[model samples]
Target: MADKEIAQDDQRVAVVTGGSSGIGEATARALAGDGWYVIVAARRVDRLEKIAAEIGGGAVRLDVTDDDSVAEFAARIDRVDLLVNNAGGAKGLDPVKEADLEDWQWMYETNVLGTLRVTLALRDKLVASEGLIVNMASVAALNPYAGGAGYNAAKFGLRAMTRVQRIEEATEGTNIRVTEIDPGRVKTDFSLVRFKGDRDKADAVYEGHLNLGPEDIAEAVRWVASLPAHVNIDRIHIMPRDQV
Candidate 1:
Protein backbone atom coordinates (compact mmCIF):
# COMPACT_ATOMS: atom_id res chain seq x y z
CA MET A 1 0.00 0.00 0.00
CA ALA A 2 1.04 3.53 -0.58
CA ASP A 3 1.88 5.74 2.34
CA LYS A 4 -1.38 7.64 2.01
CA GLU A 5 -3.40 4.47 1.58
CA ILE A 6 -2.02 2.73 4.65
CA ALA A 7 -4.37 3.32 7.53
CA GLN A 8 -3.07 4.44 10.87
CA ASP A 9 -1.82 1.51 12.97
CA ASP A 10 -3.41 1.36 16.38
CA GLN A 11 -0.25 -0.17 17.79
CA ARG A 12 2.83 1.79 18.75
CA VAL A 13 4.98 3.57 16.14
CA ALA A 14 8.68 3.09 15.31
CA VAL A 15 11.04 5.26 13.31
CA VAL A 16 13.99 3.47 11.70
CA THR A 17 16.92 5.30 10.20
CA GLY A 18 19.05 3.83 7.39
CA GLY A 19 15.89 1.92 6.61
CA SER A 20 16.71 1.72 2.95
CA SER A 21 18.79 -1.43 3.40
CA GLY A 22 20.72 -3.81 5.64
CA ILE A 23 19.92 -3.97 9.34
CA GLY A 24 17.70 -0.91 9.12
CA GLU A 25 15.51 -2.41 6.42
CA ALA A 26 15.21 -5.68 8.31
CA THR A 27 14.29 -3.86 11.51
CA ALA A 28 11.51 -1.98 9.77
CA ARG A 29 10.04 -5.21 8.48
CA ALA A 30 10.39 -6.95 11.82
CA LEU A 31 8.81 -4.12 13.80
CA ALA A 32 5.91 -3.82 11.39
CA GLY A 33 5.26 -7.55 11.61
CA ASP A 34 5.19 -7.16 15.39
CA GLY A 35 2.40 -4.54 14.95
CA TRP A 36 4.36 -1.32 14.91
CA TYR A 37 3.48 1.60 12.67
CA VAL A 38 6.90 1.78 11.07
CA ILE A 39 8.19 4.93 9.43
CA VAL A 40 11.16 3.94 7.28
CA ALA A 41 13.49 6.86 6.85
CA ALA A 42 16.63 6.96 4.68
CA ARG A 43 18.52 8.97 2.13
CA ARG A 44 17.31 6.70 -0.65
CA VAL A 45 13.67 7.62 -1.21
CA ASP A 46 13.17 4.85 -3.73
CA ARG A 47 14.38 2.14 -1.38
CA LEU A 48 12.41 3.61 1.50
CA GLU A 49 9.22 3.63 -0.57
CA LYS A 50 9.75 0.03 -1.64
CA ILE A 51 10.32 -1.13 1.95
CA ALA A 52 7.39 0.87 3.24
CA ALA A 53 5.11 -0.61 0.62
CA GLU A 54 6.38 -4.07 1.28
CA ILE A 55 5.55 -3.70 5.00
CA GLY A 56 2.53 -1.39 4.92
CA GLY A 57 4.44 1.38 6.61
CA GLY A 58 5.34 4.99 5.84
CA ALA A 59 8.51 6.20 4.13
CA VAL A 60 10.26 9.52 4.48
CA ARG A 61 13.46 10.85 2.93
CA LEU A 62 15.99 11.46 5.66
CA ASP A 63 19.67 12.48 5.62
CA VAL A 64 20.63 12.26 9.23
CA THR A 65 23.99 13.89 8.66
CA ASP A 66 22.25 17.09 7.70
CA ASP A 67 20.62 19.02 10.51
CA ASP A 68 17.91 20.56 8.38
CA SER A 69 17.01 17.22 6.84
CA VAL A 70 16.75 15.62 10.28
CA ALA A 71 14.60 18.49 11.54
CA GLU A 72 12.28 18.18 8.57
CA PHE A 73 12.02 14.44 8.97
CA ALA A 74 11.19 14.73 12.66
CA ALA A 75 8.59 17.39 11.90
CA ARG A 76 6.73 14.94 9.70
CA ILE A 77 6.12 12.56 12.60
CA ASP A 78 3.60 13.52 15.27
CA ARG A 79 4.79 10.91 17.73
CA VAL A 80 7.39 8.18 17.96
CA ASP A 81 7.29 5.21 20.35
CA LEU A 82 10.64 3.82 19.24
CA LEU A 83 13.72 5.21 17.52
CA VAL A 84 16.35 2.92 15.95
CA ASN A 85 19.62 4.74 15.53
CA ASN A 86 20.90 2.63 12.64
CA ALA A 87 22.03 5.30 10.20
CA GLY A 88 25.75 4.62 10.43
CA GLY A 89 28.49 2.70 8.59
CA ALA A 90 32.22 2.25 8.24
CA LYS A 91 33.97 4.12 5.46
CA GLY A 92 37.51 3.06 4.49
CA LEU A 93 39.73 0.38 6.00
CA ASP A 94 43.02 2.23 5.71
CA PRO A 95 45.28 2.28 8.76
CA VAL A 96 45.79 5.54 10.62
CA LYS A 97 49.03 6.34 8.80
CA GLU A 98 47.26 6.03 5.45
CA ALA A 99 43.75 7.06 6.55
CA ASP A 100 41.77 9.70 4.79
CA LEU A 101 40.45 12.45 6.97
CA GLU A 102 37.35 12.59 4.78
CA ASP A 103 36.45 9.01 5.61
CA TRP A 104 36.85 9.54 9.37
CA GLN A 105 34.79 12.72 9.24
CA TRP A 106 32.00 10.99 7.36
CA MET A 107 31.89 8.12 9.81
CA TYR A 108 31.77 10.42 12.83
CA GLU A 109 29.09 12.61 11.29
CA THR A 110 26.78 9.77 10.38
CA ASN A 111 27.38 7.49 13.36
CA VAL A 112 27.76 9.99 16.18
CA LEU A 113 26.25 13.32 15.20
CA GLY A 114 23.42 11.75 13.27
CA THR A 115 22.31 9.79 16.30
CA LEU A 116 22.44 12.90 18.43
CA ARG A 117 20.31 14.92 16.02
CA VAL A 118 17.52 12.37 15.68
CA THR A 119 17.54 11.58 19.40
CA LEU A 120 17.18 15.21 20.38
CA ALA A 121 14.43 15.83 17.87
CA LEU A 122 12.31 12.84 18.85
CA ARG A 123 13.15 12.89 22.57
CA ASP A 124 9.94 14.56 23.57
CA LYS A 125 7.84 11.99 21.78
CA LEU A 126 9.86 9.16 23.27
CA VAL A 127 9.43 10.72 26.70
CA ALA A 128 5.71 11.16 26.13
CA SER A 129 5.25 7.47 25.41
CA GLU A 130 7.90 6.26 27.81
CA GLY A 131 9.33 4.58 24.75
CA LEU A 132 12.56 2.78 23.89
CA ILE A 133 15.73 3.88 22.12
CA VAL A 134 17.97 1.33 20.41
CA ASN A 135 21.44 2.33 19.33
CA MET A 136 23.10 0.17 16.66
CA ALA A 137 26.59 0.15 18.02
CA SER A 138 29.33 -2.32 16.98
CA VAL A 139 31.99 -4.52 18.53
CA ALA A 140 34.42 -1.94 17.25
CA ALA A 141 33.28 0.15 20.15
CA LEU A 142 34.70 -2.42 22.50
CA ASN A 143 37.71 -3.68 20.56
CA PRO A 144 39.83 -1.71 18.13
CA TYR A 145 42.05 -3.25 15.47
CA ALA A 146 44.53 -1.82 12.99
CA GLY A 147 42.87 -0.01 10.05
CA GLY A 148 39.73 0.42 12.17
CA ALA A 149 40.66 3.44 14.22
CA GLY A 150 38.06 5.77 12.76
CA TYR A 151 35.17 3.31 12.97
CA ASN A 152 36.24 2.42 16.47
CA ALA A 153 36.29 6.02 17.56
CA ALA A 154 32.83 6.69 16.17
CA LYS A 155 31.24 3.61 17.74
CA PHE A 156 33.01 4.23 21.03
CA GLY A 157 31.52 7.70 21.05
CA LEU A 158 28.10 6.20 20.39
CA ARG A 159 28.51 3.78 23.29
CA ALA A 160 29.34 6.66 25.57
CA MET A 161 26.38 8.64 24.33
CA THR A 162 24.07 5.71 24.92
CA ARG A 163 25.34 5.33 28.46
CA VAL A 164 24.73 8.99 29.16
CA GLN A 165 21.22 8.81 27.80
CA ARG A 166 20.48 5.83 30.01
CA ILE A 167 21.77 7.67 33.05
CA GLU A 168 19.83 10.86 32.33
CA GLU A 169 16.61 8.99 31.71
CA ALA A 170 17.03 7.00 34.91
CA THR A 171 17.84 9.96 37.09
CA GLU A 172 14.88 11.89 35.75
CA GLY A 173 12.63 8.86 36.38
CA THR A 174 11.24 9.21 32.85
CA ASN A 175 10.59 5.49 32.61
CA ILE A 176 11.94 5.51 29.08
CA ARG A 177 14.21 2.62 28.11
CA VAL A 178 17.62 2.89 26.40
CA THR A 179 19.48 -0.01 24.86
CA GLU A 180 22.79 -0.30 23.02
CA ILE A 181 23.13 -3.28 20.70
CA ASP A 182 26.72 -4.06 19.70
CA PRO A 183 26.69 -6.42 16.78
CA GLY A 184 29.81 -8.36 15.83
CA ARG A 185 30.63 -9.44 12.26
CA VAL A 186 27.25 -9.08 10.62
CA LYS A 187 27.30 -9.64 6.88
CA THR A 188 25.65 -6.73 5.09
CA ASP A 189 26.56 -3.69 3.02
CA PHE A 190 28.73 -2.62 5.94
CA SER A 191 31.86 -4.15 4.45
CA LEU A 192 30.98 -2.96 0.99
CA VAL A 193 30.76 0.61 2.13
CA ARG A 194 33.84 0.26 4.26
CA PHE A 195 35.82 -1.05 1.31
CA LYS A 196 34.49 1.73 -0.91
CA GLY A 197 32.62 -0.63 -3.24
CA ASP A 198 35.35 -3.21 -3.59
CA ARG A 199 33.38 -6.39 -4.09
CA ASP A 200 36.26 -8.71 -3.39
CA LYS A 201 37.24 -6.90 -0.25
CA ALA A 202 33.68 -6.93 0.99
CA ASP A 203 33.23 -10.59 0.15
CA ALA A 204 36.44 -11.53 1.84
CA VAL A 205 35.23 -10.17 5.14
CA TYR A 206 32.49 -12.80 5.36
CA GLU A 207 34.15 -15.62 3.44
CA GLY A 208 34.24 -18.81 5.51
CA HIS A 209 32.83 -16.96 8.45
CA LEU A 210 29.58 -17.59 10.26
CA ASN A 211 28.27 -14.08 10.40
CA LEU A 212 24.96 -12.81 11.74
CA GLY A 213 22.36 -11.73 9.25
CA PRO A 214 20.38 -8.51 9.25
CA GLU A 215 17.33 -10.41 10.50
CA ASP A 216 19.22 -11.48 13.60
CA ILE A 217 19.85 -7.91 14.67
CA ALA A 218 16.28 -7.00 13.77
CA GLU A 219 15.03 -9.71 16.08
CA ALA A 220 17.07 -8.25 18.90
CA VAL A 221 15.62 -4.80 18.24
CA ARG A 222 12.07 -6.11 18.17
CA TRP A 223 12.50 -8.04 21.39
CA VAL A 224 14.02 -5.11 23.24
CA ALA A 225 11.28 -2.79 22.08
CA SER A 226 8.59 -5.32 22.96
CA LEU A 227 9.59 -5.57 26.61
CA PRO A 228 7.32 -4.17 29.31
CA ALA A 229 7.66 -0.52 30.26
CA HIS A 230 9.16 -1.45 33.63
CA VAL A 231 11.95 -3.46 32.01
CA ASN A 232 15.08 -1.76 30.73
CA ILE A 233 17.81 -3.52 28.80
CA ASP A 234 20.88 -1.35 29.13
CA ARG A 235 23.12 -3.06 26.59
CA ILE A 236 23.59 -6.29 24.65
CA HIS A 237 26.44 -7.59 22.51
CA ILE A 238 25.31 -9.90 19.70
CA MET A 239 28.02 -12.02 18.17
CA PRO A 240 27.84 -14.92 15.76
CA ARG A 241 28.83 -18.33 17.09
CA ASP A 242 32.07 -18.19 15.11
CA GLN A 243 32.77 -14.52 15.50
CA VAL A 244 35.01 -14.86 18.54
Candidate 2:
Protein backbone atom coordinates (compact mmCIF):
# COMPACT_ATOMS: atom_id res chain seq x y z
CA MET A 1 0.00 0.00 0.00
CA ALA A 2 2.06 2.91 -1.34
CA ASP A 3 0.22 6.09 -0.50
CA LYS A 4 1.09 9.28 -2.41
CA GLU A 5 0.63 12.77 -1.12
CA ILE A 6 -1.00 15.35 -3.33
CA ALA A 7 1.55 17.29 -5.33
CA GLN A 8 2.62 20.57 -3.81
CA ASP A 9 2.78 22.16 -7.25
CA ASP A 10 0.13 22.34 -9.96
CA GLN A 11 0.52 18.84 -11.35
CA ARG A 12 -2.84 17.17 -11.90
CA VAL A 13 -3.52 13.73 -10.42
CA ALA A 14 -5.30 10.85 -12.13
CA VAL A 15 -6.36 7.54 -10.60
CA VAL A 16 -6.57 4.57 -12.97
CA THR A 17 -8.14 1.37 -11.64
CA GLY A 18 -7.32 -2.07 -13.09
CA GLY A 19 -3.85 -0.68 -13.71
CA SER A 20 -1.96 -3.95 -13.52
CA SER A 21 -2.33 -5.01 -17.14
CA GLY A 22 -3.89 -4.49 -20.56
CA ILE A 23 -5.74 -1.24 -21.21
CA GLY A 24 -5.45 -0.06 -17.65
CA GLU A 25 -1.68 -0.36 -17.67
CA ALA A 26 -1.40 1.30 -21.03
CA THR A 27 -3.60 4.17 -19.95
CA ALA A 28 -1.50 4.79 -16.87
CA ARG A 29 1.64 4.97 -18.98
CA ALA A 30 0.04 7.28 -21.47
CA LEU A 31 -1.18 9.67 -18.80
CA ALA A 32 2.16 9.69 -17.09
CA GLY A 33 3.84 10.48 -20.39
CA ASP A 34 1.62 13.52 -20.70
CA GLY A 35 2.76 14.80 -17.26
CA TRP A 36 -0.21 13.71 -15.14
CA TYR A 37 0.69 12.34 -11.73
CA VAL A 38 -1.08 9.02 -12.21
CA ILE A 39 -1.96 6.69 -9.36
CA VAL A 40 -2.24 3.14 -10.73
CA ALA A 41 -4.55 1.02 -8.59
CA ALA A 42 -5.04 -2.73 -9.06
CA ARG A 43 -5.00 -6.03 -7.21
CA ARG A 44 -1.48 -6.97 -8.41
CA VAL A 45 0.73 -5.16 -5.96
CA ASP A 46 4.06 -6.23 -7.44
CA ARG A 47 3.13 -5.26 -10.98
CA LEU A 48 1.61 -2.03 -9.75
CA GLU A 49 4.84 -1.14 -7.91
CA LYS A 50 6.93 -1.75 -11.01
CA ILE A 51 4.63 0.30 -13.19
CA ALA A 52 4.41 3.05 -10.64
CA ALA A 53 8.17 3.22 -10.29
CA GLU A 54 8.78 3.23 -14.02
CA ILE A 55 6.21 5.97 -14.64
CA GLY A 56 7.30 8.03 -11.62
CA GLY A 57 3.80 7.72 -10.18
CA GLY A 58 2.16 5.94 -7.27
CA ALA A 59 0.56 2.51 -6.99
CA VAL A 60 -2.01 1.20 -4.54
CA ARG A 61 -3.51 -2.26 -4.16
CA LEU A 62 -7.16 -2.10 -5.05
CA ASP A 63 -9.79 -4.73 -5.72
CA VAL A 64 -12.72 -2.82 -7.11
CA THR A 65 -15.15 -5.61 -6.21
CA ASP A 66 -14.21 -5.48 -2.53
CA ASP A 67 -15.69 -2.71 -0.39
CA ASP A 68 -12.95 -2.64 2.20
CA SER A 69 -10.28 -2.58 -0.49
CA VAL A 70 -11.91 0.34 -2.27
CA ALA A 71 -12.38 2.27 0.95
CA GLU A 72 -8.79 1.86 2.01
CA PHE A 73 -7.54 2.61 -1.49
CA ALA A 74 -9.56 5.84 -1.62
CA ALA A 75 -8.28 6.91 1.76
CA ARG A 76 -4.67 6.88 0.54
CA ILE A 77 -5.30 9.31 -2.28
CA ASP A 78 -5.61 12.97 -1.38
CA ARG A 79 -6.87 14.42 -4.65
CA VAL A 80 -7.93 13.24 -8.06
CA ASP A 81 -8.38 15.37 -11.16
CA LEU A 82 -9.26 12.43 -13.36
CA LEU A 83 -10.74 9.03 -12.56
CA VAL A 84 -10.50 6.26 -15.14
CA ASN A 85 -13.00 3.55 -14.29
CA ASN A 86 -11.17 0.89 -16.24
CA ALA A 87 -11.33 -1.87 -13.64
CA GLY A 88 -13.48 -4.45 -15.45
CA GLY A 89 -13.57 -7.36 -17.92
CA ALA A 90 -15.64 -10.21 -19.35
CA LYS A 91 -15.89 -13.50 -17.51
CA GLY A 92 -17.38 -16.23 -19.78
CA LEU A 93 -19.15 -16.49 -23.10
CA ASP A 94 -22.14 -18.75 -22.68
CA PRO A 95 -25.59 -18.63 -24.18
CA VAL A 96 -28.61 -17.62 -22.11
CA LYS A 97 -30.08 -21.13 -21.88
CA GLU A 98 -26.78 -22.58 -20.77
CA ALA A 99 -25.59 -19.55 -18.82
CA ASP A 100 -23.43 -20.14 -15.78
CA LEU A 101 -24.89 -18.18 -12.94
CA GLU A 102 -21.50 -17.91 -11.28
CA ASP A 103 -19.98 -16.42 -14.40
CA TRP A 104 -22.80 -13.93 -14.68
CA GLN A 105 -22.40 -13.01 -11.06
CA TRP A 106 -18.68 -12.45 -11.46
CA MET A 107 -19.16 -10.32 -14.55
CA TYR A 108 -21.88 -8.19 -12.99
CA GLU A 109 -20.05 -7.80 -9.72
CA THR A 110 -16.76 -6.81 -11.31
CA ASN A 111 -17.96 -4.82 -14.27
CA VAL A 112 -21.07 -3.04 -13.00
CA LEU A 113 -20.84 -2.93 -9.25
CA GLY A 114 -17.10 -2.47 -9.31
CA THR A 115 -17.44 0.78 -11.23
CA LEU A 116 -20.20 1.92 -8.93
CA ARG A 117 -18.05 1.39 -5.84
CA VAL A 118 -15.04 3.28 -7.17
CA THR A 119 -17.10 6.10 -8.62
CA LEU A 120 -19.07 6.66 -5.46
CA ALA A 121 -15.95 6.59 -3.33
CA LEU A 122 -14.21 9.15 -5.54
CA ARG A 123 -17.20 11.22 -6.50
CA ASP A 124 -16.40 13.86 -3.89
CA LYS A 125 -12.79 14.16 -5.00
CA LEU A 126 -13.87 14.55 -8.61
CA VAL A 127 -16.40 17.21 -7.66
CA ALA A 128 -13.77 19.18 -5.78
CA SER A 129 -11.48 19.15 -8.78
CA GLU A 130 -14.24 19.61 -11.35
CA GLY A 131 -12.78 16.50 -12.88
CA LEU A 132 -13.46 14.12 -15.74
CA ILE A 133 -14.37 10.43 -15.52
CA VAL A 134 -13.73 8.14 -18.45
CA ASN A 135 -15.61 4.88 -18.09
CA MET A 136 -14.16 1.97 -20.10
CA ALA A 137 -17.13 0.38 -21.77
CA SER A 138 -17.21 -1.89 -24.84
CA VAL A 139 -18.94 -2.39 -28.19
CA ALA A 140 -20.72 -5.27 -26.46
CA ALA A 141 -22.66 -2.59 -24.65
CA LEU A 142 -24.04 -1.40 -27.96
CA ASN A 143 -24.39 -4.60 -30.01
CA PRO A 144 -24.87 -7.91 -28.25
CA TYR A 145 -23.69 -11.07 -29.96
CA ALA A 146 -24.99 -14.59 -29.53
CA GLY A 147 -22.38 -15.79 -27.04
CA GLY A 148 -21.93 -12.51 -25.13
CA ALA A 149 -24.97 -12.43 -22.89
CA GLY A 150 -23.17 -12.02 -19.58
CA TYR A 151 -20.63 -9.50 -20.80
CA ASN A 152 -23.24 -7.60 -22.76
CA ALA A 153 -25.53 -7.26 -19.79
CA ALA A 154 -22.73 -6.02 -17.58
CA LYS A 155 -21.53 -3.47 -20.13
CA PHE A 156 -25.08 -2.34 -20.85
CA GLY A 157 -25.60 -1.70 -17.19
CA LEU A 158 -22.36 0.28 -17.13
CA ARG A 159 -23.41 2.31 -20.15
CA ALA A 160 -26.70 3.13 -18.47
CA MET A 161 -24.86 4.24 -15.36
CA THR A 162 -22.47 6.42 -17.35
CA ARG A 163 -25.34 8.16 -19.14
CA VAL A 164 -27.29 8.76 -16.00
CA GLN A 165 -24.26 10.07 -14.18
CA ARG A 166 -23.53 12.49 -16.99
CA ILE A 167 -27.09 13.83 -16.90
CA GLU A 168 -27.09 14.14 -13.15
CA GLU A 169 -23.77 15.91 -13.07
CA ALA A 170 -24.92 18.39 -15.67
CA THR A 171 -28.25 19.00 -13.97
CA GLU A 172 -26.60 19.58 -10.62
CA GLY A 173 -23.94 21.92 -12.07
CA THR A 174 -21.10 19.75 -10.88
CA ASN A 175 -19.00 20.60 -13.97
CA ILE A 176 -17.76 17.03 -13.92
CA ARG A 177 -17.40 15.63 -17.40
CA VAL A 178 -18.28 11.97 -18.00
CA THR A 179 -17.22 10.05 -21.07
CA GLU A 180 -17.75 6.43 -22.15
CA ILE A 181 -15.14 4.71 -24.28
CA ASP A 182 -16.28 1.72 -26.32
CA PRO A 183 -13.62 -0.28 -28.07
CA GLY A 184 -14.54 -3.12 -30.43
CA ARG A 185 -11.59 -5.48 -30.15
CA VAL A 186 -8.24 -5.02 -28.50
CA LYS A 187 -5.46 -7.61 -28.55
CA THR A 188 -4.81 -7.85 -24.85
CA ASP A 189 -5.27 -10.45 -22.11
CA PHE A 190 -8.99 -9.69 -22.40
CA SER A 191 -9.82 -12.67 -24.58
CA LEU A 192 -7.51 -14.88 -22.60
CA VAL A 193 -9.30 -13.99 -19.37
CA ARG A 194 -12.70 -14.28 -21.05
CA PHE A 195 -11.94 -17.86 -22.04
CA LYS A 196 -10.48 -18.59 -18.61
CA GLY A 197 -6.88 -18.94 -19.85
CA ASP A 198 -7.68 -20.97 -22.96
CA ARG A 199 -4.90 -19.55 -25.11
CA ASP A 200 -5.96 -21.33 -28.28
CA LYS A 201 -9.54 -20.12 -28.11
CA ALA A 202 -8.46 -16.60 -27.21
CA ASP A 203 -5.95 -16.46 -30.04
CA ALA A 204 -8.58 -17.45 -32.57
CA VAL A 205 -10.64 -14.34 -31.90
CA TYR A 206 -7.91 -12.14 -33.43
CA GLU A 207 -6.19 -14.79 -35.50
CA GLY A 208 -6.47 -13.19 -38.92
CA HIS A 209 -7.50 -9.64 -38.15
CA LEU A 210 -5.48 -6.54 -37.52
CA ASN A 211 -6.82 -5.84 -34.08
CA LEU A 212 -6.45 -2.70 -31.95
CA GLY A 213 -3.90 -2.74 -29.18
CA PRO A 214 -4.18 -1.48 -25.61
CA GLU A 215 -1.98 1.52 -26.43
CA ASP A 216 -4.43 2.68 -29.07
CA ILE A 217 -7.24 2.86 -26.56
CA ALA A 218 -4.88 4.40 -24.07
CA GLU A 219 -4.12 7.14 -26.55
CA ALA A 220 -7.82 7.78 -26.86
CA VAL A 221 -8.13 8.10 -23.11
CA ARG A 222 -5.24 10.53 -22.97
CA TRP A 223 -6.78 12.66 -25.67
CA VAL A 224 -10.14 12.69 -23.94
CA ALA A 225 -8.58 13.82 -20.71
CA SER A 226 -6.57 16.52 -22.46
CA LEU A 227 -9.58 18.41 -23.71
CA PRO A 228 -10.57 21.69 -22.09
CA ALA A 229 -12.61 21.45 -18.93
CA HIS A 230 -15.65 22.97 -20.58
CA VAL A 231 -15.58 20.42 -23.40
CA ASN A 232 -17.48 17.22 -22.69
CA ILE A 233 -17.20 14.33 -25.11
CA ASP A 234 -20.26 12.25 -24.41
CA ARG A 235 -19.09 9.00 -25.93
CA ILE A 236 -16.45 7.80 -28.33
CA HIS A 237 -16.54 4.47 -30.19
CA ILE A 238 -13.34 2.92 -31.53
CA MET A 239 -12.66 -0.33 -33.40
CA PRO A 240 -10.20 -2.12 -35.59
CA ARG A 241 -10.40 -1.47 -39.30
CA ASP A 242 -11.52 -5.04 -39.90
CA GLN A 243 -13.95 -5.06 -37.02
CA VAL A 244 -17.50 -3.80 -37.60
- Write candidate 2's Cα lDDT for 1-244 as tens digits: 5555565488999999999999999999999999999999999999999999999899899999999999998898889999999998887888899999999999999999999999999999999999999999999999999989999999999999999999999999999999999999999999999999999999999989999999999999999999999999999999999888
**Which residue pairs show backbone clashes in model 2?**
none
**Positional deviation of residue 98's Cα in model 1 after best superposition, in angstroms:** 1.8
- lDDT, residue 83, model 1: 95
Model 2 ranges with Cα > 4 A deviation: 1-4
Off by over 4 Å in 1: 1-9
lDDT of each: 0.92, 0.94
Query: How displaced is residue 84 in candidate 2, in Å?
Result: 0.3
Deviation from native of the Cα of residue 242 in model 1, angstroms: 1.1
Q: Estimate each model's TM-score.
A: 0.96, 0.98
lDDT of 2: 0.94
Model 1, residue pairs in steric clash? none
What does the lDDT read for residue 111 in candidate 1? Answer: 98
Tens digits of per-residue lDDT for model 1, 114-177: 9999999999989998889999999999999999999999999999999998999999998889
